[model samples]
Target: MRLKVFEFDISNSVLINTQTQTQHHLTRTEAQVLEQLANHPNQVMSKGQLSCAGSQQAVMSESAVAKAIFTLRKYFGEPYIDLIETLPKKGYRLNISTPPPEWQQQLAQRKKLIILASCMMLIAAITLITAMHQYIWFKTAESPVRESRVVTLNNHQQIELIWLQSPKKSSQQVSNMEQKIITAFNLCPIVKWRDVYLAFSNDMQVLNISMQGYSSNGELLVRNIKTSDFSLQPNFISPNWLQEVSLCD
Candidate 1:
């Protein structure tokens, strides 16, 4: 039942910063308001909605919600306080602008990979031009149907999650499989991959999950798992299995 916001633990009426090793116990009202905001990060929420969420009444004064927000921001202190934004006429929005240090490092590594790939592609293009006199035959294979969804993080960054449908499986079967994968991912404590791909076999006997991203050392890494070797629950993928495959550490 715990939810994470970057390094913060937004669960059990407590706010914890894992990086700083600091814990802040929240008031009942504060916890309710913060949970509402965390559950819908980056979206504007009015004070009335927030107050009613905490009080569970038809109407609570906006001032109570405002006070709760002020207290939460005060607890956040300095730079982190900016995570909760207050709009004069609109409402409050939880917009996390800063990403963790490891995330920033990962992004830098990805940029280097892109540059190296571009250089390789340029060299290959030049080589192809020189061999233009030779007939180059290329055979293209048909690709499986894919449905992509962009998962937005608390920090406003996005990662693409793609589901590749097996030709033999019905549309409903593929959609249900994708939902199970998504649920497991959503429950993961830490997600470092830039993209994820889930595919099924033509006979529906094998299921493959691939996570594509660069490791800490700037090396391209693909983590794979298959149902043939792993047992899945009737409803969702196992959280332990996800952490084992999805995380490099």
Candidate 2:
């Protein structure tokens, strides 16, 4: 079974972060501990139980188990690390219950709030930039509407990646776009990409993505290269824009 702890997307032994669109390779011992804790969820699994979760022939010391857990926590960062709760003499558990009563409901609504916030921020920033420039003109492009993929060459350049949903689009088209996005992320700093944040409209058809770039004083540049098929209405599921999404407050 696969599991996600916060930003980390676990598919068998491989861990990927949907936000950064980057892969997180875990050590064998870390994988074992993560799987064991993820499998059990809210229930505490003793160090012995986690150590034996993988190869029965391979023995793991209690200290080794502790180290694995420590490393796993550090890798995933905050909030997520909080999910791994330690028990005195017992072991550890994934504490998804660490929240108010309606945490999942809050998660569902978070997408909309983020989209709204991003739009506002972008608009405000652009207005300020326009005031600074003597003149500005935007160009229109005519090309096959491909799903959004953002890559930046400098720290001062920000890019937007939008995934659209349309009746004319086949499921495969959406899949291909996502695969391309993932490939771009895999290319990393070499591809000129830095960071990522995920957001979606209230209807869930549109995705609002933010890619990190350069700061104004640091080398300002404004380029909104949108590649979206206007014929299609964006659907959150089709492009599976954030299909492998995992949340951490």
TM-score of each: 0.38, 0.35
lDDT of each: 0.70, 0.59
Model 1: colliding residue pairs: none
lDDT of each residue in 145-238, candidate 2, tens digit only: 3455664434334445555434344566456555555554543343332344343333434444444554435653233323333334543333
Best by lDDT: 1
Off by over 4 Å in 1: 1-12, 54-59, 97-119, 127-249
Alpha carbon deviation, residue 142, candidate 2 (Å): 94
For candidate 2, the 10 contiguous residues with the lowest summed lDDT are: 240-249
Off by over 4 Å in 2: 1-12, 54-58, 97-249
The lDDT, on a scale of 0 to 1, for candidate 2 is: 0.59
lDDT of 1 by residue, 106-215 (tens): 99999999999999999999899768735565556556646888877554446787877567767776677766665655555555678878777765667777888776
lDDT of 2 at 196: 45
Worst 10 residues of 1 by lDDT: 1-10
Give the Å shift of residue 113 in candidate 1. Answer: 6.5
